[model samples]
Target chain A: MATEEAAGGLAFHPMDQFLVRPLFGGTEIHWYTPTNVTLWMGLTVLAIVFVLVIGSRGRAIVPSRMQSVAELTFGMVHKMLEDITGKDGLKYFPYVMTLFCFIVFANFLGLLPTAFATTSHIAVTAVLAVMVFLGVTILGFVKNGAHFLGLFWVSSAPLALRPVLAVIEIISYFVRPVSHSIRLAGNVMAGHAVIKVFAGFAALAAIAPVSILAITAMYGLEVLVALIQAYVFTILTCVYLKDALHPGH
Target chain B: MATTTQEAAGHAADAANAMLPGTDAHGSAVGMPQLVFETFPNQIFWLLVTLVVIYFVLSRIALPRIGGVLADRAGKISNDIATAEELKLKAKEAEASYLRALADAKAEAGRIIAAARAEIQADLDAATARADAEIAAKTAESEVRINEIRAGALEAVNVVARDTAAEIVAAFGARADAGAIEAAVAARVKG
Candidate 1:
């Protein structure tokens, strides 16, 4: 460690990798600024179009490779929506599909070298989670009318415990979005930061081999985490949607 | 590790310094870049735009097109199956008619054989009847001829016996009258 510091110090700037810099040279990050966020988000949108729009453009009876992938993604989300929220939930297909496609593409795209993971940011995931939270709550109220409050009211609990259980249920219900957003961002950020930390150790010749091995392993896990996080986020939305539709239990 | 890396990055940035956005004046991240308040607006705006675009693209164009394709494929498959089934029915009908024609031909052959047999049987019966009638008429004629011959032979024998009786009466020398002898012969013949 002493020798490494004496060797003009190790160049360890892991957090700099996440710096949201302007694509065109300027320091001011306005709301409309064309930053790396815009570039990555735009790429994410293009990736979605490639898969969903162009992939299924053939409309072949026997599907092409891209077409089948498109169909598989569509069917998987559709089935999840049906399983959780039943037939009426299919009306929200476009909304649900949008979230799924955006998250999945952003996540996978972020795995590339020097790519910014838009989904790893709290500002981003929180927006999606809060949207889902508000949408579900509103949908619950609209669908079930006054009966939507039954979600927190535990009718099945013993008379003495009902109020206490209701309070707990209310707390947990409100905590959904917080946990939801943090779970994705935290998972993604933690994996990336870990890999970066390992990258820092690669500066020393003695530790380079082991450090690279650790980075490799973490990278593999991150790949899995990327897809799984997308799936987890979308499925959770479906579950919340189900709750909104059927608030009795 | 965080402080050490931050210090090192700080020094490095200082040497070749230009403070990047989302970093401190020393070019190290203030904390986590994710916590940077300034970039939130940029990320949120872009994300909203992306989501809205994706939603519109999918609902308006992608989804409906994919769904239409699926439905079209299904409908086409069923239509093909129906056509195949109709052809199969037609084939079956053709086979049945073929079998019916085969049976009719066999029935016709049987009818022809029966008619031929009946005609042969009738001709054989006619020939047999004609042969039997000819044999019966020949036998009747032969019997009539035999009866006539017998009658003629019986008259000759009667004439010889009358002549012999006359000669015997003359040889006895007490000659009875020829008319008396003839009367005796006639009485004997009558008795």
Candidate 2:
């Protein structure tokens, strides 16, 4: 509640943007609270339906503008999963597509003025990453049995160093979810926080022009980050699916 | 804001900040709202719901339709290309058949012309032979007629000469027989 800057008349509350307040005017935030998270996530769903379902209602061989966009997203995610995991992985195309559309739509929608980024939350991204991690791990085990653990074992390494290499690989495998989740949340949060900081500086007319320029530049970078982070997340998910489908090396 | 409203801005900041998991009594964020552990449950629950909803929507509806559209486009393009190729083959066949018909017609025309020329030459030869035969016959008849007239004229002249000789002998007071006069005239003529 006490920002040192706020007491010093700086009045910069950048982190305030991410607060989880109830949508129906209440201070309490229960697990089922219809908060801004709900609002934005709902909007993300509507946007997806609008583009993917209603946009392609024409089912035109020559697609409309929105249909083209819908097809582009669908094709990109579909190809990424298929390329990484091959044909057998196509069964999980919808799941991968779900992750991609959720993150991408959430990221883009968050860029709007006064929009709360659901993807920017660690809790949200962590859940998504952990779901992919658990699902792939389970799938690997189911498909390959005990051989799934061989993903950590370096078969090419010398026998003496193989165990150590396995240890390293194991650590890296566990770190995937942490890094994956944090990377998306961190990138989004940093860009937004920096923009907020710049906005705070804009109240001072002397450096308002500089602050505005910085915000504009940061906005451009944030937009790029938003799209790139979604791509990164989807690609990583596909990569993990690859490991699950073929848990050899 | 100026220095006077420093405390007031913090109060305003409190108005925006939900005094939830990571906020102090003054109602500003303790650290990052993203790190607050208490709200994780809400965010996670919502995220799960969203993911499930998206999965059903995509798997059930969107993906199949989009895939169908792509498949349909590909099929249509290939089908159209196949049709075009068939049409091209048909055109080529038609052109080849047309050329063959033209060549056949030309050959037939050439044959008819040759036959007509041969027939015309034969008719001309027959007409020329008939005219030559007719001219040969007419010339032979004219020669015979001329020979007959010469003989008749020669006889008349001889008779007149004999009469003239007899009249001259009588006028000279020396009578002469017609036989003698005739014999003399004949002998002089023979000499």
Candidate 3:
């Protein structure tokens, strides 16, 4: 079966080109440039513009339908941030909310059959991670200034071993962004690859009922993974933003 | 050193062959799958732009408008309630004033009627007193004239008695007593 042939890599994989872009003369783009990311960004801009224009037009005390929806979404995100970061965590509301909306929409866009999962790629995930890392780091300095550097040291450790503990803590603190980025990319990529494998198996199977059931089950699981991955990305973002605002905990 | 370099080269070749687009030793090309990172510059640019746009909108426009609408609604409701309360108080005050005016008017009307009745009674009493005094003076004058007429009639009656006594004395062979006859006639008149 072609499915088996493709799975075994005996056949040239069409989707394999969806990786790092090969720069041609430094200016031209490569085949692996993810269109999915562009589509998601376009959709997000449209959504934001639509909400802003329509939701605030009348601004009545009794909210119109659009305004009500806008308010509800805001309240939901605000409450979620408060729950994750506690009451004083409201300062990070804008950052966390933006991250959640962007990631959730991006993940959903990636689930389409022809769409590329940009978040599944290390490059894209790394870019997002770097932004979070930079933001949190800068915020820590802005909020706490010099004291923020103390987060790298376990000051409560025994005086004799405090130096060693501080070094370890600093290394661990530096590792947070890498781990956070890799976890999202790895999970999304692994899930999509597994689903592709299962689908290939069902396509090659001679029996109809068994293969159909297997594909159905895998499809359902893929949907669940999509939702879970989005949630994981959003929750981690909240955690990181919180750390920036309150470094001690 | 030559053997070690050859071994390293061989290892590198093996790793390359395994990553090739062909079946691996396990006959599963899925094994040692090469997941790469390929993000379009345009997409990255757009995504960042979208985020910034959304953040600006949420902070500046939507939230403030929603809050303003709510505050305006609350203020309008409170003002309406306050106005209604004030109007109710004004109505109560007006009703009190109206009732007071009505009572005062009734009291004034009663006083006017009492004064009118007193004036009418005084005028009627004055007219009655004048009529009674005039009637008493006329009666006194009538009684005095009646006394004067009776005295005149008594004198005439005495003269008539003297003439009639003189005729009786000449007709009979005896003289009549005029003074005793006059005294008897006056006593009969008195009785």
Candidate 4:
């Protein structure tokens, strides 16, 4: 590709440097590296802080409209936690609710053209997945001690097959993090890539009109996918958290 | 027939692939390395940090506050309702007592009027009996006085008759027999 073409936004690729690049040498820092994650995380944090500050400011006998909204959101999340985990599930509500809000906002932020979809990268998603995996696992062990290991074998299993059953259970348990991470990453990556490809057609002069329409439709679909992915990720985390808190049941 | 369509799609895909040298149909593998970076570690770190923070905030702050507020609200509402109900019951009892008192007052007033009437009737009956007795005594005395006056008038008439008989006998030159005279005087006296 010519320099002129490059300057004119001619792609080596449309999603070329999704990763952050270092400003000084690679040793110092990279701009494109986790560019989306940083921005999203910042935005999410700011939004949460703003909500909390404004929401809690007017602790009145009767809530102001903003407080009411905050209350409504809290109530909704509380009810959801109560529903999923039963009453005992309430102890973990804050963690689950905050996780939900943060992820949802982060995912929504990625929809912007200039923004990075951090979750689209397997590395980022996998890291998040592993944390949940490890945290829940540790919590389980700490809470139930060696009894948590019994999650592998059905207490009612036939005596002869208990060992074999334990192996399968262990394998399945180990695969949990992998499946969880890949599910989120694959969905986000696939949706974004598909949108990018459709968008590429709009660049060509001959197919501009049809390509624009198709890309527009795909963009709309991608937005829905973004929200769904966020919801799926959050709910799955709740499930894992549940398993950890109470291993068998 | 399905195979034919698949083959046609495959042919179209092949043509497209020929047109674009380095593109996956899914467009995911383009410009990406064969050895993908291991995402496990990074995902684990961020998620763990987020979970811990959220857990702490919820357990320590958010949930406690919300729970407290909800409990407070519930307590206030129940208290208010209980107070209202108690007041209503008190009002009902007070109203019932007021009505009962009114009814008793009316009954007492009625009884008082009845008692007063009985007392007035008794006094009137006593007065009437005394007056009747006094009238009877006066009537008896008047009758005795009338009998005395009648007796006096008859005595006077008797005296006059005796003198008149003696005179008339002397005037007629008739010999006045002593036994006859005596008999006539005795008759007058008896009359």
- Give the number of the best model, judged by DockQ: 1
Model 2 stretches with alpha carbons more than 4 Å out: A6-8, B1-18, B133-191
Task: Give RMSD (Å) of candidate 4 vs. truth.
Answer: 10.5
Please tell me which model should have the higher lDDT, number 2 or number 3: 2
lDDT at A120, model 3: 70
lDDT of 4 at B12: 40
lDDT of each: 0.85, 0.87, 0.64, 0.64
List TM-scores for all candidates, in order: 0.78, 0.84, 0.56, 0.67
| lDDT tens digits by residue: candidate 1, B1-191 | 34533544454466555555456655566567888776787788899999999999999998898878778888999999999999999999999999999999999999999999999989988888887787778777777777777766655655655666778876675577777876777677657
Clashing residue pairs in candidate 1 (N, C-alpha, C atoms within 3 angstroms): none
Q: What is the interface root-mean-square deviation of candidate 1?
A: 5.6
In angstroms, how far off is B2's CA in candidate 2?
46
Candidates ranked by DockQ: 1, 2, 3, 4
Which whole-number lDDT from 0 to 100 does residue A190 have in model 1? 83
Report the Cα lDDT for residue B95, model 3: 100
- lDDT, candidate 1, A7-119, per-residue tens: 44675666666778889986666678799999999999999999999999888999999999998898898889899899999999999999999988998898887898888
Q: Encode model 4's per-residue lDDT on B53-117: one tens digit a residue.
A: 54565556655665566567778899999999999999999999999999999999999999999
Best candidate according to TM-score: 2
Clashes of each: 0, 1, 0, 13
